[model samples]
Target chain A: MSDSPIVNEFNQGPISCHAFNGDRTELAICFNTNVVTIFRKSGASWTQTSTLVEHDKPVTSIDWAPKSNRIVTCSQDRNAYVWTLDGASHQWKPTLVLLRINRAATFVRWSPEEDKFAVASGSRCISVCYFEEDNDWWVGKHIKKPIRSTVLSIDWHPNNVLLAAGCADMKARVFSAFIKGIDKKPAPSPWGEKLPFNTLCGEFSNGAGGWIHGVAFSPSGESLVFTGHDSTITVVSPGTGDIQSIRAPYLPYLSVIWLNENQIVAAGHDCAPHLFERKGQQWAFSASLDAAVKKADVGFTARDTFRRMDSRAQSTTSTDTEVHTHHQNTINSIRSFSGTPEHVEQFSTSAIDGKLILWNADSISRGLGNLHL
Target chain B: MAFRKIDIDALEEDAFGEDEIDFQEIGELRPVADVDAQVNSRAQEVRSLLQRGNTSGALSTSLQNPPYGAPFHAAKARNTQTVMEVLNSIKVSDVPQLVKSLSPEEQDVLMKYLYAGMAAPEQNNSGHLLAWHEKLTEVAGQGCIVRVITDRRTV
Candidate 1:
């Protein structure tokens, strides 16, 4: 339980986004560029497998659908491509999606059922795209109403009908992405009854209006939680419209993932993941995944102090430029590394500093418990 | 036959299309200011106006306040076109002077706002955003803005 996480630092600069294969053995990462490189994991190390280059601009997001073995990537080029592997040649093929967005696509996510996916764009709308047999390619249906600004992130419900979108409009909205051709009639849920295409179930914002950065559905799909640029995380239980927003003491979070029904892990500009727990009717922040280690000040001496004073003439004592955390820079994404969304045993976080760190859930909950985290 | 009736309520094919406005052109929707009596709150009031896409309204409000009133927030919106509009309508130094008068803490928050505006390296908005930031930092003094970002405890 005390063992360190597996650290993989790439010298290839920042990773714009990354996704893992169904087996968790291969990784698809964009090196802050248009290219997506796939890496195969061998033991504790990783090896490059393939590079998919189709977009003419930087890729903003990536999602790997496990069941279908398909990789979907959206880029600032106002385009998205679905990559499929050719079994005979072992080459990845790109299929363009007709998003029809005039601006950059900001984020994307695959539906729980993996039959379709949603791409959020700076065009003030979301494009729900899926395969069309008649057209022999993927087609998109736009949901443009009520979104006055860019959407920063999106998540699909377990039922595969409702979608939660966090947009720059300072609101988190739940809209039904029920395509007439790709989906069947969805059953009634807490979100709403008689779900149709483009149905906005509910919209929410924090006490202080802030741009929403991250959103996710609880494992039970009964509640939704989102983080905003104002350094706050809000939870909404649509059943009773119970909203609890926590103004975090730390910096803003860029993304969030439900660890289970009761717990969530969020990370962003703070560069470290923080845990939140729900008990009964109350939601509260519980612990830091990377607990701050107190460094003893035993090495300071008069000679060093005088040397420092003579060098810069400043009284600043600390010289360490890095935060005492696993990630040295802003962590942009946190994805499930092992286990299903219902019960994640481990997860991975990638940062702008080009480092990937994987954490074991059991150890985190156990290790931090002793520290009263 | 020439005056056939039509279903006037039918939805247009491109009703929700984004050709009218690009996403980058949208204004930052920060919280509107409450009608507080304090001068700092009044500064925030001008800012709220910009957040709501009321550039002219912000200028008028700042004018009514007189003396120290400056459209500090309207400049911070960083929409480029909006800021340029306000600048062209007044002295370019007016907003910079107001930003310059902001306390060290206020400058840090303003820098954070600018940093967020430069989000997404691929968005290619850093050049414009950085230009404003450089001017503001110059007024705020060297290393003051960065000290806030690097050490949250400082502010």
Candidate 2:
């Protein structure tokens, strides 16, 4: 609808999304209905890579393994399914189905170094499973705790030996890996002789009326940053056990990603994405998109169409008052990739308001010469 | 009924029959029974406040508006006497020697508080210099006491 570049648009509707590989060349979009669509970008155009329909419930989370060609998807049915891309048929097929977990899996992450994957269950436990060469998946470890008041978010350490999980209890816990015989002998147990991974560290009180929704570790793995419904962003020194809390004017930061060591990008409940930088001993807001621009970028634009639609929305909003006055859906999530100095790509937000809006960060940084004010 | 002003000097001369007053007689002076009871009750109130983690309020109440004939007056007097005695025992010249006896970790901890002027007064003989020296000794290993004294001269 605008002059912004549209990477791709899906008529089937996308509810959740994840990248297919490290390069983010392919994207997998999960629908509210049972369908999952894979799209690929080719020469400024997006082609439907493949569409798979296997789940009866909405897909809650999707993750791509670091060392394998497999994709993992967990849904409301309380099962995690693994899919592999078949080059010959140009289709994605379910390879391994892990069932009988007895709880809905909300988040899934792949370890950085190994074939191990961490899945957060609704029952307040993180299950660590590893894929074997024989194409079979085995539960390697399980970190269990008391029943949480709500579902928790879990992420793997950047180097893969540690796992960090955030609970409704308002605490973030870290668990480190222990190798049998090399580091310590694994005690024999009924759940398999896997080394007992205990909580090495924990922080904050969920009872303080702030529930930690998401937790992310810096790329260097030296510091941990977390956001909660309390509208507070906390930076914790894992080494010293010191916490520095900064409150955002808007409460409930839904998601956060590390742009680099010193900078963090977050999406707030206000439907705006904010960039923050660690200045001296405190974190300060650097930049934020206006509400109108955020709405236009996330609403009508589809995932691949986001990059192209961004510029057009900006131009139209400047000249047209009606377009500026329109109410749009809130942005739910944002994903940015590192690209060449000339171009940067971001993906899937609220498609109802045109989510797929792309901008050239390098050019924008040089000055808004190309943009119409 | 009107009050009469008596000559206290002449009365002391008649009572003790000495130019110098008897210190023992002065010690025997006591308040009325009701006054003593009231003072003790108020002292208990202050102690309870301190125990309840209201240090700032307790300190303010005791120092700013002490109860008349408060029993805590005697305790405060004794604490001051003890602090004075401890301060009198330390020689200004021995500060460097005392500082040299502390360990490295102890030296760092003590130096941080000394530089910030946060060292406890009672523990440091009530002198800023003495407090800094005492803290330095406590942190630096006793074996490095000599190094502290020599380093103090260079600085």
RMSD of 2: 23.4
Candidates in order have lDDT scores of 0.76, 0.52
Highest-scoring model, DockQ = 1
The first chain of model 2 has a TM-score of 0.75
Best by TM-score: 1
Which window of ten consecutive residues has the lowest lDDT sum in model 1 chain A? Answer: A364-373
* Candidate 1 lDDT by residue in tens digits, B1-155: 25858744257454432232222223332233421233345467767887787655654454342111122334333232333333334334455655655554445545554564566446445665676677776666433443334321110
Best by lDDT: 1
TM-score of chain B of each: 0.37, 0.26
Could you give candidate 1's per-residue lDDT for residues A286-357 as a string of tens digits?
888886665665437887777778886855677575378878899999988887777887889999989998
